[model samples]
Target chain A: MKQYLEIAKILKNTHIVGPYWKLKLSVSELAHRASSGQFVMLKVDSDQGPLLRRPFSIHQVKGKTVELLYEVRGKATEILAKMKAGQRLSLLGPLGTGFSLCDLSYVPLLVAGGIGVAPLVFLAQNLRNRKGLAILGAQKKERILCEKEFKATGFRVKISTNDGSRGFYGRVTELLEELLAKDTLLRKKAFLYACGPRPMLKQTIMLSKKYNIPGQVSLETHMACGIGACCGCVVQTLTGYKRVCKEGPVFAIKELTEEGLAE
Target chain B: MTPNLSVVIGTLKLKNPLLVSSGTFGYAQEFVDFLDLNILGGIVTKTITLFPRQGNRPPRTCETPAGLLNSIGLENPGIKVFIQEKLPYFQKLKVPLIVSIAAQDEISEFVELAEKLDKERLVAAIELNISCPNVRHCTKKSNVKLIAQDAKATALVVKAVKKVTTKPIITKLSPNVTDITEIALAAEEAGSDGVSLVNTITAMAVDVEKRRPKLAMVIGGLSGPAIRPIAVRMVWETYKKVRIPIIGMGGIMDADSALEFILAGASAISVGTANFINPNVCSEILRGICGYMIRHRITSLERLRGAIMC
Candidate 1:
């Protein structure tokens, strides 16, 4: 897809859940061009203090509007949180390879942990016609995000919280293992996809491999350019070092090494 | 009437004065989908060594106030792979291709790399990257000192590479030094055609909460708008000491910054960290420079070079 650099007007900026801020932007070109799992490099401020552009996944797209779910992590995000509606943000994107949804035979299963649900929400929205399952995980009930959004898509949504305050008491991977073991038919047709913290992703990859199921993962890394130029976000894959920004924020289960999964 | 933006660095003549800094613009192919390669003054390939380097471990980069600290460790495919796999792609480009090469501890390795690249007719010039702050010399005696930090070592490497290739040599110097002019003079005396300064400043960042270094390598090189003034000052100092041309780079984000380098006495300027902010930044900078020239009615950059009225 073609990328663009345009100033997007902030349509809405509100706190979604604990620590998560949802930003809605009016950028026609990017809203139409961006696909599931693609991201934009957002310039938070015009000043030199927070100079580097921070990468944000396209949370949702409706006509000329795009949504981004971010947490206040550092100086840049702190600046981004203070932005009010009608403010303009310089955005460069529709960049990097997005999630591939070509196979029609397998059952789509989206597994997410905490804020990693950002891109999966976009993925789930695009799979409205397909009968899929979403396993959303968080530290506690309050941290579980996009459960309503995923369920609204007419997909089976499962919640897992570490504190046992939600649907499942243990990790998402354990719940996945239990579900996969009980459904023999699902074991054959399940196509697992995940995005989350390193430990969760590694466990998910391990579970996927044990079941011999086809899977894809969206990765996160500290980036500079978000394009292939910087080489800052490289992850060691089976094929060697690959830029997580350009080659992927998403990769197939087999393409990554266990080290990459942990990273 | 258009202003003359073309610049001559040593034996090579560029169509303009906006070369993309090495390492920032990967082998020239990465930007093809985003920009027309022909518009650039030149393309400098990433620094290559005699053998493949698998760079530093993860968390290689961290964003500072207006800068970026990177400990990439010069990860590159060895010279052999670059010639066989990468050079052909650069050869097809319409603009001049300057190859940047770095050596471990031995000067002979630098000579070997120069000899191998000398046969490639597509190479417009050779840029010796003796000042990369990311990698340290493995030799026991060198004690991890960067080659550009010592004038004698810089001269020896330049003279060794100069012996093998007729291609104009441009020594890329580091800013993390006491006197940059001494290094520039040494390179010029050793038969370097021109010089490019300054490579990223050696720096470190900390995650105060975690109480650890941000990068795995502990210290990396700093680049961005933060280093522009220091780079301009170094260029001015180096320009006064050396007769050869100067390619000034460091925190060059726009035409104004590029012009600052030119006015401070850089014959040419490179856009580095700004390329990360905007992929089309180089072209914008080129146009900005042209617009400034048209407004000032300065027909040639030669008239304005070093015209900084003290």
Candidate 2:
């Protein structure tokens, strides 16, 4: 449970390795306590022009800071991009149960779709041995974000583009399937963690279930308070309705029922 | 240096006048990360009833032009769970805790819930939530005068609860009244220590494509910046009419907006819908007010309170 923090600075404003539309906000705050899949809500306007803050997954957390990766969608993100250095941002964060990979012993498999690649980068860096592979997918080769960042972490990287302009002319899951077919050992000990769009998460969770691989995926909802109050961001669970901010942005594949996913 | 951000709401001396209203702040425990709870005057927990309420069905909330509409129906863990699970957390908080109590059917249930709260010394006060405007027939009747009568009856229960504990009783008022001052006066006459005004105006949203009510509950309470002016006017009128202290609130997302409430005769102010817009609105308001005091050379904050010239 990370408290609300003030943004100390707006560090680098570089686009990801691929020509993807995703941008990263290098916020100055040590969300080390923040796990792989938790998120932070950023106030887009200081004057209260926007009636609600925006929630984004913690893509990467370096020393004394956390990185937020998001695409320019709607007016909020566009306003966020216009923010400059030294402007204070009231941020509510480290919210939701982030990805839990602490129990897994062997190498891990991290998957992301488009802007979904945000959280997995932090997850890979968190592993002590760099003991995992990252599979990233986007609509086209130019749309893939965070390619070089994942590559620099010393993990095996695979890219898939829908237009066949990149490494594989298919989805990231196809690459994962190819890797699994080639290396039987890879599938035995590795655990999977994915965060991305709703459709991609639904498909990935299904595939993980079919393969009998233990996996977790971060869920998305419209969060109002970001705390447990309001219950604006509720996700149906096996037990009952749980807040996406309190119970998760991440849940085990088995925790969520089939009906819970947006079909 | 500014004198102090302290003010009196009834007999309670708060460190500051900024508080988070019920339903928006949840229990005090949830805001431990981003907020300095001790710095706040108090925290009004979400409305609790005799039994656990699942609240209204979702799409419980929708954003309006400058505000939000919610039919949360006061969802809570009930008094028993609140006492068992939520009370200990409030005890740990550095700020004063004001439990917002609500009920259904019988007025005796309000008495019972207040009675249960009476034993706890951890609470600084109780903000009676009789102004729930979301659910149909939630109140005794939709009439403002009837709402005032109900508030009087509820205040009698609070007075009884006050006997068990010395904590002040603050009755929160609904905005659907024909004259908010009448309800404010009724609460004071019934022995309410102080009062908070503007707990969401009754409203409905349109599903234009479907040509029907947008909310599942058919109607919801409107809050946020859209209703700030109405809240200010009502608070101003209530302050003029009532002798007791007033805690004014409505769409108060910033210090300037909150100042308007204080100027309009609110002894203290609470942040409601603004919390949804910006998580730091409370602290920002606090800082902003302090800055205003310094910049304006105001020696004391109370001197500026209810100084609405018009």
Candidate 3:
């Protein structure tokens, strides 16, 4: 509820990895309350089409600046990629439920796939536990992201690539299975947290159940009012359809329907 | 140099003509952080129903060229819970509270919901949301009919609700109908205080690569700048047909578009999709309207209302 609508100036818009663009905005109030897994809705400064504001997960916040990592997807981001520094963009944020950092007794893990790593970097930096692990995955080595940033956060970094261009070949979920399978202590004490493609997060849920570990997945859907209003960006759950914008961009792996990702 | 921006709908008076449209504005609480709720002439709560609805499946919305398609089938707490929980917040907001309500095709359900809201002192008026695309499917008949789609049905619902509630009733109309003025006139004849139109147009989109509909509801309501012209035309036509006030909406992003509605005969304007893009849009739009009125030296909105040259 402690949200603000502020016009943010882009301080830097830079390329980091394949299809990944980092947008840093100088909107202190917006950055002040933002937490990991919380997102900001960015409006295209131009009166250009796509009419609605695009939601982006809070990637990182340093000092008074907030960073958003977005993939150049569709018309919105394509226009966003061409944006330069000093250009003012309207932002509504620190919106939605964010990942909760609790129970330091459990082993912490950050699992991200492709650009899904956007929010996890901020989570990784803020997570209270040391000796945490970050599992990063992408299509290729060139596509892998946030390895150094995660490493800098004092967390162990694991990598996977579909094309075998990175540390471990195969889906990140495969590497996660192997990691949890070999170590009974890791399986029992580890708490998995993930945000990625639906198939990957869906598999993560399956693995959490297989190992009896608790996990959370940050979801993305087509959204209009990034607040609870529009009733768009909903996903089916055991209770009913819950808005991804208000109830969560983050939800417990257990609360979702088995086929919740399909729609 | 501030021009009088106040407007009225029925006995309900407004400080300004800018009310944040329901659904997009979220009961006025979600936007209290962005702008002062008092700045709005009124704020319409999300459409509530007689019973709690889980709404449609996932993928309820999809973005399109210059617009958005939504199939959120009026997911809301029933009137009982809405009054118990959500209605309290409105007491703090200085703006007039217009509660939008939807129900099954049953006129009784609509009447029951309106009666419940009528008891609340905070309720300034009730917007009959009989135009939603989802309402079209609620009928048991195969031919699909939204209450707002048929003149008689629109009249029946309006008259029944009107009889039960002493509060002003604004019948919301759909653009999907053949001639919107027919239904607007019907609502007016049935004793509706005013009419708000056009609701989202029935629309669809396809994910070509996946060969699937983008929305789980396959067909959703289209809103935004894409439907503005059609809405203006409908407002103009309805203004000519009905004596009741017209609350114009459809892709109204700024003052220019809002003024277009007023010139086309809308007594007031509601900002919808634009609120999703900029939470403070209502205030910005209100500012823009005052700026225009001062420039044109138009002392009253009445002069501008239906002042279209054409």
lDDT of 3 by residue, B1-310 (tens): 6688888788999989998787888777888788888999999888998888888876888889899999888889888899999999887878899999887656688889988888899999999998888544347642447888888888888989988999999999999988998999899999999999989999999999999999877999999999999999999999888899999999999999999999999999999999888888888899999999998899999899999986
Q: Least lDDT summed over 10 consecutive residues: which range in candidate 2 chain A?
A: A17-26
Best TM-score goes to which candidate? 3
- As a whole number from 0 to 100, the lDDT of residue B81 in candidate 2 is 96
lDDT of 2 by residue, B15-123 (tens): 8888899999888677666666777888899988888876665567776777788887777889999989998986666788889987665556667877788788887
Tell me the tens digit of each residue's lDDT in model 3 across A1-263. Answer: 59988888999999876678999999968777888999999888566676888899999988889999999988889899999999998888999998887477877888999999999988888874467899998899988888888888888999999999878899999999999989899887788889998898888988988889987889987788898888888888877888898889999888975588775
lDDT of 2 by residue, A10-94 (tens): 6554555443233344454446577878888877774645678778888877666777877776667767766665655666667
Off by over 4 Å in 2: A1-4, A15-33, A46-48, A84-92, A102-107, A128-133, A151-190, A209-211, B1-16, B54-63, B71-73, B92-94, B134-167, B202-219, B275-284, B287-305
Best by DockQ: 3
Per-residue alpha-carbon lDDT of candidate 1 for residues B118-183, written as tens digits (9 for 90 to 100)? 999989999999998988753555644888898988898899999999999999999999999999
lDDT by residue (A131-162, candidate 1, tens digit) is 89999888899988988898888778998989
- Can you give the lDDT of residue A81 in candidate 1? 89
What TM-score would candidate 1 get against the native?
A: 0.94
Q: How accurate is candidate 3 locally (lDDT)?
A: 0.88
Query: In CAPRI terms, where does candidate 2 land?
Result: acceptable
Among these predictions, the greatest lDDT belongs to: 1
Chain B TM (all candidates): 0.98, 0.93, 0.97
Q: What's the C-alpha lDDT at position B175 in model 3?
A: 95
